[model samples]
Target chain A: MQIMVNGTTHEVDVEEDMPLLWVLRDELGITGPKYGCGIAQCGACTVHVDGVAVRSCQLAAGDVDGEVTTIEGLGTPDALHAVQEAWIEHQVAQCGYCQSGQIMAAASFLETNPEPTDDDIDRAMSANLCRCGTYPRIREAVRSAATKLMEA
Target chain B: MKAKTLAVAALIAATATTWAAGETATTTAETEAPSVSVADGLEAWSRIYEVASHPRCSNCHVGESGIPMWSGPSYGKTRPHGMNIAAGESRIGAEFVTCATCHTRSTQGNTVAHAAPRVDMDWQLAPAQADWFGRTSQEICSQLRDPERNGGRTAQDIAEHLDHDLILHWAWDPGGGREPAPYSLQEHIADVMAWGMAGMPCPNG
Candidate 1:
């Protein structure tokens, strides 16, 4: 199978039913998307598909056949994305298992909702559970990123 | 005139007592099930209670940032979760102190001066909305059924949501201080479905 991740194309062989998360972590060795829960509950495996954040754990390999982006793909250490910066500014992570998911969810949220209110953030990010209880940071990151992204 | 005033006072007292009784009834109803059969409902009650009372539910159920009285301040505020040292949004702070700096994915319990540090399985914090605590099952049920309110899901979508969505499944995987729900995810869904199928009943009783 041929899959594109973060703009690079890779060819691999695996079960069609294999979860995108497993394929990424095991076959491709793209371990950025961690596996907190095989189910999408933890949002720890959140990644971007064509710019939309999705739970890679719940998505089948056959399902996400397009461009997939993990946390590594989002930005670089030297040139960090605004969301990453905002996450730092807001101190969003606690346990850090769910930060990738929180970041992915925030990124996806900002794409459409460039400027979100508290309620909008709640409704959008509710699906992405942060067990570390970094929700306040998630919201703050979203707000800060929105401002930063809009400025950019 | 005095006799008439006394009569009106007695009527007023009776009305006030009725109002007080009504308030008490609501309080009981709020704590107990909306109906009678829920006595065997301990399992069901606990499942709902766990989900409702868990940090995921309690944190959001409590208060947002900048409230007069914060529910759990151990996380931080200006830092989005304020405390000892703050990480901006990046999890890594201004000095490049990432959330991973202290809060690694796993911990036994990292202690903070003002508040205790989380050290359980993936201990961190539920998002800001977690402050919304002490919700009744029926209220959560209603929230789950409403697409506009419940994360943009429809009635049928809710069934799929429960089936496929994982965080909902986390009630069964609550680690450390938190235990999994008394009932399996399927059973909770079934009860939720029963209510959903019954037109998402809210307790008038």
Candidate 2:
């Protein structure tokens, strides 16, 4: 099947039930989305499907009809996304294993809710779990990212 | 309330007598004839109980809160559905992030272990009336037979639902390390159809 990932359409051969996570990491060699709890329980494998954050581990490569975006596609290294900038500003990464998923989820959440209250952030980011418990920093980073996006 | 309870008791007694007579007649009927007695229906219900109590079915058939549960042998711990997910009153998570935001139709055949299992339908929690978590088999049987609780489905409708609903089929296709519900889908469907045809009796009722 042909899937557009990070703005590049690649024809890949894999089973219809193969998760997009493996397709990204093993097949395409895109490793931003980590494997935390292979099940959807953990948000470590979050990615964007048509601008909405979804667990890549749960999503099938064949089921992806939308444009795919991973952390690598979120922004160039030279010009970081607002969320990335705020993540750096807040020093959100502790172990950094879940930061990519967190950042992806936050970016999607902010797209729909550019100015979110604490509750909104909680509801949106609740799916993503960080074992390091960087939740306070995550909230602060989201706030900062929202402000930057609004300004930009 | 006392009078209502007494009336219900009397009706059950009357039905029991009639059902006993029906069973006797069914015993002498043609071999092809279906056994349509309350006892047979309740017997079929025992099988349904096995399927319903399984994590694949019970996890999504939650209570009034509309929060799906995650428990049983596969999860290793019984708890609320992960990701702090909530379906709200919509039962489809529309009040928040919809289930389809992650669970899509038609997953790949070779999905990794512990990966989110996918099916070919829009995934959502069962309605409040169909809530089965922490319920006894008798209670679940009563609820399934109750028109109000079972979506006003008639016995035939219930059979059709069991035979066809793709989401319900997920019980047998639960990928990853999750165990499928007891019995094959075909056997479960047969039992469900028989129970419906036999008057959908509850063991306690």
Residue-level lDDT for A115 in candidate 1? 76
lDDT of 1 by residue, B1-205 (tens): 1112111111211111121111111010012123323222333333445555654335423333322122333333312232222222322332212232223222222122322122222222233332335567655555555556666754435544545433444445434334344555445544443344335544422
Q: What lDDT, from 0 to 1, does candidate 1 have?
A: 0.53
Candidate 2 stretches with Cα past 4 Å from truth are A13-18, A25-31, A35-37, A75-91, A110-120, A143-152, B1-35, B94-104, B107-113
Compute the interface RMSD for each candidate structure: 14.9, 2.7
Worst 10 residues of 1 chain B by lDDT: B20-29
Query: CA lDDT, every prediction?
Result: 0.53, 0.76
Q: Give the candidate number with the greatest DockQ.
A: 2
TM-score, structure 2 vs. true:
0.75
> Any idea what lDDT model 2 has?
0.76
**Could you tell me how far off, in angstroms, the CA of residue A150 lies in candidate 1 after the best superposition?**
1.2
The DockQ scores of all candidates, in the order shown, are: 0.03, 0.37
Estimated TM-score for each candidate:
0.44, 0.75
